[model samples]
Target: MKEAGATRTMKRAVNIRIESKQAEQTQTQQAKGELYEKNGAYYLRYAEPDGEMGQTTATVKWDETHIKVIRHGDVQSDLTFRSGVRTTGGFTLPQGRLEMEMYTHGIDRKLNEGLGSLAWSYDMYTGGAHVGRIRLRLMIEEDRSE
Candidate 1:
């Protein structure tokens, strides 16, 4: 895969799987999104279903050491992650929006031969109370049907 940028007219199909656990409750979600790379950063844009909370569009941006995730539409959030550093953002729920803190443990990224994977884990806190740890795995593959 090209590292700098994707072709302007090309859009690759990406598959995303996410598992989130809070307290004793766990949820798993899978979706298809569009993948594009620009200026050395890769982006994934997808829609998220929240049942009673409605739906939202999510955009994820990542480079070598940092990742930023944002959601819009029905819910909103902006979270950033980097290993060994704490980042702050906002999380929106049906009840309300709250400030959030995330401390990343590790991030592993690999992209080659039209396949890409990113793995990361982080600790989350809200209002000085520990929420839970989260692990995320993302995989992307080029759609070369053209």
Candidate 2:
């Protein structure tokens, strides 16, 4: 790991494929973004459409034990995922912030040299009621076009 005051971040244009499955519905979204490494962790930074909220910036960082997703701009959040752990995180919307929690049951990752995939499955809850089981998968690769 680098020192606390020293950090290295390499910005690389990358093509990403994100797939999420909730209940019987599955949504897939793709975008081009930058993937970087800093403080001994890998992070993916991207922009996503947010309907009336315009564009939302998303940053996903992960290590061996946990994964964190953060959003800024219109909609903001910081959600953490870990195996056998329930993490509390909510969404900040235009109207108000809605509190939510998620219990992660499975997490798997295999990344090498800034190119690979990672996945996780969890159950989401709102107001202490079970919403649905969500499975998310991400595939990342270095952009060859540079």
The TM-score leader among the candidates is 2
Give the C-alpha lDDT of model 2: 0.84
lDDT for model 1 comes to 0.77
Model 2 lDDT tens row, 1-146: 22232244768899989999998999888878898777777789989743654679999988667899999998898899999999999889999998899999998876775567889999999999999999998899887985
- Assess each prediction's global lDDT (C-alpha) against the native: 0.77, 0.84
- Write one digit per residue (lDDT tens) for candidate 1, span 8-126: 43557867666666567777777778877676677888888446546889898887779999998778899999999999999787778999999999987776522577778899999
How far is 62's C-alpha from truth in model 1 (Å)? Answer: 0.1
Residue pairs that clash (backbone atoms under 3 angstroms), model 2: none
TM-score of decoy 2: 0.90
Question: Per-prediction RMSD in angstroms?
Answer: 3.2, 3.5
Candidate topping lDDT: 2
